[model samples]
Target: WRLAEKAAVTLVDRLICDLALDVDRHSVGETYLAHRPRHAGGFEKEAEATQENYGVAPEILTQSQLSSAGLAGPFYGAMTTPIGFGLNPRKYVAGLYKGAFAAGTRFFDRSPVVQINEKGVTTSQGHVKADKVILATNGYSSEDIPDWMAGRYMPAQSTAIVTEPLSDTALEAAGWTSDQMAYDSRRLLHYFRLMPDRRFLFGMRGGVFSSVSTEAVARTKVVSDFREMFPAWAKVGISHAWSGMVCLARGRVPFVGPVPNMPNVLAGFAYHGNGVAMGTFSGQLLADMALERRPALYPAAMHHPARRFPLGRMRRALVPPVYAAYHLSDLRR
Candidate 1:
């Protein structure tokens, strides 16, 4: 922080000397003293060394490479951003996996398997058997289980954006040459950083998003957002806006492993937006559990079978009043 302050003052001096073209000895002396920049961010302290342990950068598997048969669908890419400019470097990454995954295992089970229809009613057709049954649906799941197991899942969204490349002039003006990810502190927070290419990607929570969304809406929000967050980026444009449906548990933790009492069936998902790391973590742990027969899984509040909040019409009626009261309590910024 102290270093940043010193550099900020030096920047102002350079601006006055170059832009204002203040060359006179007396004018230069006065400008140097008066033009020192004040710290807009109250960065008061500095910390020492920190350590990180990052693992492998996993490869992106394609349709042909999958022995398990990849989904036939569209492929997309994006960038994420976190808003806090000077602090919280990893807040964005704190919620992602740079690259991590474990190799898949093959199973040739021929015993018996059970088939449940879309309605979830078990049907007695053909053979009901399999040596093993695994549910590898990672997030974005919606299926009804028994009342006892209903609390074990969810479906939520993750929104992200990517910007067109910035010009050198624009980059200099923004003074964000150091490309690092960032995010801010909010219950529903925004996270972002830069990309391998020169573009920026920012992501945040809270928005009703879908695949049918239009480019106009995405670019409008992103470009308007660019003007506000980065006024110097006048020529920049938004190239894309996309969303991923992530799973969540009530406790905001991953819901992994076998369903409490379900026989032979195993499940792994419920990332809570921190999946890149936790998802793989759960995978490794689950593998270990299956091999060693230790704890098959952890309890998530979402899986807490006993949770009963206001639902249906009651939720519709009670939420507005409670939400309005929350907004009413906000101070005039």
Candidate 2:
């Protein structure tokens, strides 16, 4: 938790200090253990560490306070500000690309990379040789890449479902008027947020198998779980459902450094689902490394090369059993 807080603070600092981006950040504080009291002590310890390190003490709210805020209660609560905010990634990326293009950055859309060697990257149309090549492909990396990358990263799928726009009365009934992003404490957790358009975005970690049948089953389960949790909005219809891959390293940490034995080639990936902020920090670090800048910001562990997974190609087959175990554990909890 401390490491994550530090990394998040560092990213926000860099965005404000170096990039001069006017991030529309909000301070809709988060709540933990809102329905469970057994985990209160551990949560209090976490809040204490966060306060000591970041100078922001989290407030422990009671059931009455949570209910007054239109939240389902029987929870041991802790609230921390300057930690919860939502950014429109689409706008951010568009602005970034526009600036990059204005600064002479070229775009080669739809041109898939065919290979990456000591010389440079090879595209389907042609080869573009360069002195330095930075591979930033996360979960969507091509199979033709180096053995180390193929063996080290496991691409897992994450699924989400968003509802149609809800009326104010419906939102109130669901106890979701706060508009704060929230996630529950569970082995296989559920994350949700109230969108600006009054719709709700509910997501969970599943869909590890890429087959159509498996995805359909996972989607059904997610919808069922959402309905079960938000029974007040039982009649709310799902407008969209989607899934995407997330790269996970064997040690469950991101890596940013030179590929062993691959001269002039650097790779950064395996975000473990916290991609937005962590990826931004990684890109900055990679840029510094490319320019031979001194005094890197992140830790040595983050810069270390990722260790390869055993039975690399067959790792995907283990998803079902792994998810089953996690779900079973959640039930036990």
- The C-alpha TM-scores of every prediction are 0.53, 0.89
Candidate 1 residues lying further than 4 Å off, grouped into runs, are 1-129, 136-138, 145-152, 208-211, 214-223, 293-333
Clashing pairs in 2: 34-75
Instruction: Give the Å shift of residue 333 in candidate 2.
Output: 4.2
**How well is each residue in 63-86 modelled by candidate 2, as lDDT tens digits?**
557656655533455354445465
What global local distance difference test value does model 2 have? 0.73
Compared with the true structure, all predictions reach lDDT values of 0.41, 0.73
- Using TM-score, give the best candidate's number: 2
TM-score of 2: 0.89
Q: Which ten residues in a row have the lowest lDDT in candidate 1?
A: 27-36
